[model samples]
Target: MTTSESRDEAVGSGDVDFDHHSLTFRDHPHEALAELRSRGPVLHSSAHDGFWVLTDYASVFEAAKDDARFSSAESVGIPASGMPFPILPIESDPPQTQQLRAITMTPFSPGTVKSLQPDMREIATELIDAFIERGECDLVQELTTPLPARLMLRMLGFDESTWRSWVERVHLVIHDRAHDLDAAMTAAGSLLTELGTEMERRREAAPTSDLYARIVHGSVDGVPLDDVQITMYGFLMMLGGMDTTSGLTSNSLLQLCVQPNLRQRLIDDRSLLPAATEEFLRHDTPTLGLARTVTEDATMAGQSLKAGERALLMWAGANRDPAVFENPDEIDFDRENKRHLAFGVGKHRCLGSNLAREMFKVMIDEILTRLPDFRLAGEPVRFSDAGEVHALRHLPVIFTPGPRRK
Candidate 1:
């Protein structure tokens, strides 16, 4: 058989070995991906225990777009034991996915998020105030984590009382092993069930202008969304909004802190914040990659992939692909044409991307204006193990507390 045919058969059968590579690919994934991209864009690998990884920009993007050709129904990587429900729209497709997106999109629109900006700014400033007083703080805990959680809670009309528990549950759910997975999943499910019931009650008794009420009572094609769908969507929104943005924020700050010159530049000229955000995202995409199962035999970069095989669309690798990005390793804040897959590509692109960009803009603008010369107090811990989300576990920084003007 031809090389392409062999690779195709491997991918089609979900027969790639995943154990050869290191757990996180922390040292040099870009270089490895580049080698794969050059040799064969869609090569099969039985690494990381066993899973097919699709490396390269064009092929990964193509796989992501053609959902029909690459199904998401199968257990992608390792399933969380005892979690009966599939992880929202991420694990779903077509009509159901579209319906869920429509309902969830209402609260995350530009207008809705823009309206919440003032409140977000206030919260950001409050956190900054505390950090400034201390002169040193952990950015992840003090700033990044809380900001997004608060925004998500407010958007969903959920009580702040449960925020800590919910956030903890999510972190554990994502990071913990199979033994702890059941408890984590149970906590998340129970929390959502309560929230869903409360949402339904509010919808019936006094429909509010909040997102929860809207989704609980909303309809698509004259069909009202069921409780499970609403709850799942809410869970997704909460998870998506909190973790990814928090990761982005912490990663951005970590990058800025490490690169003193960039920090000074942003301090001197706040106009570079937008470009800086893009650079940070491209350099360290929050979500690493998404998984897909091949549905039929197909050719990718001259390699034929067969039916019912699993493959990972490496967004992180694609973002760093030299063919698409100039000087992919260098962090160019002033990049003229930034087209990174930090938020993904194609139809399943992150729906909250616009909101995420705006959030970063606002948060970064506030930080530049306040703590301009922030420096790292210690080494930042990168969360490289969360299969798809890349983030920093802790980012300790020291800075002169800027005066609270606002």
Candidate 2:
């Protein structure tokens, strides 16, 4: 309850001292996950007020599919405290979650993301340009934080001027352990206010084509969405579409920074970009896990569970499950089994996967192309909380100062 994970106490049938929310868990996620995977697929953690961990790939996947058994209504994250509201699409079940997803796709669809590529590239260039001549910069601050934030703001049809403020609040709420619940709610409230006002404004009149407009007027299969319902989409926009992708990009770059050989391969041949991104996602999953409330009594992998039990599908651990993946410990772009649940699986899979994947490609493409020789300037400052999302707080890198791209 206090720490994300402290010492072990016994819980359900599968007793394991695993806590994804813990500083200890974040510090050595692989070792901890390995222990859980070895011991039990359905592990009961006496941490964060006792929850089960679905460490094995099969168990997690099966449970992900059985929506009735494993519902998303409780909490998507292991609440350090409590959130005022549940994030839309994520916390909602099918029909509603699926319906909101239908509207959400309009903004992030393949063509939409493709059309924005020039802008994305330009923004990437601009950010790198600022630090390219300095020989060194905090990649997390200089690049990672802003790229996805700017893009997300554009997607949600927000004014560009407020990007930094939103980004700051997002980082504080998500990556900062000290302000997890309060800051998350405060930031969520702030966005809800702005998004609500804008949504109402759009509903009144004088509308243009933007993601916000579509959602405000969105009716899935003819059922209309209301204002409060629409604003919940805003909540999802702020939480799902922003810092999570930032974490993905930052973690990918950090991988390249440390592994010079892996860095060089992608730089030499851009064809490797897509697969490479997958490997990076697999290696350092941005989303550590997702939470589900067990709604009915069930047996998973032969283990029985009661209704109302909380289970965390440890995606990071599942991605690294030795049974499914060969040499799971090694980071291999060419690794044959690239099926990672980094972006979750089943009905509740990440709605922003297209955007996330493309952003990772561009971010990595730009970094390797521009700062080919950049290496870690210092040790990375990782997030204190690694339960919901495993993220990098700061990553300093140094390279030969290069001329700015025209």
Query: Which predicted model would earn the best TM-score?
Result: 2
Error of 2 at 359 (Å): 0.7
Residues 11-79, candidate 2, lDDT per residue (tens digit)? 445677665667888788888988888887877767777777888898888878878778886667665
Off by over 4 Å in 2: 1-13, 176-180
Candidate 1's residue-wise lDDT over 136-213, tens digit each?
888888878888888777877878556677777667655453335566677777767776777768766866877778
List TM-scores for all candidates, in order: 0.89, 0.93
lDDT of prediction 2: 0.79
Clashing pairs in 2: none
Per-candidate local distance difference test = 0.72, 0.79
In model 2, state the lDDT of residue 269: 89
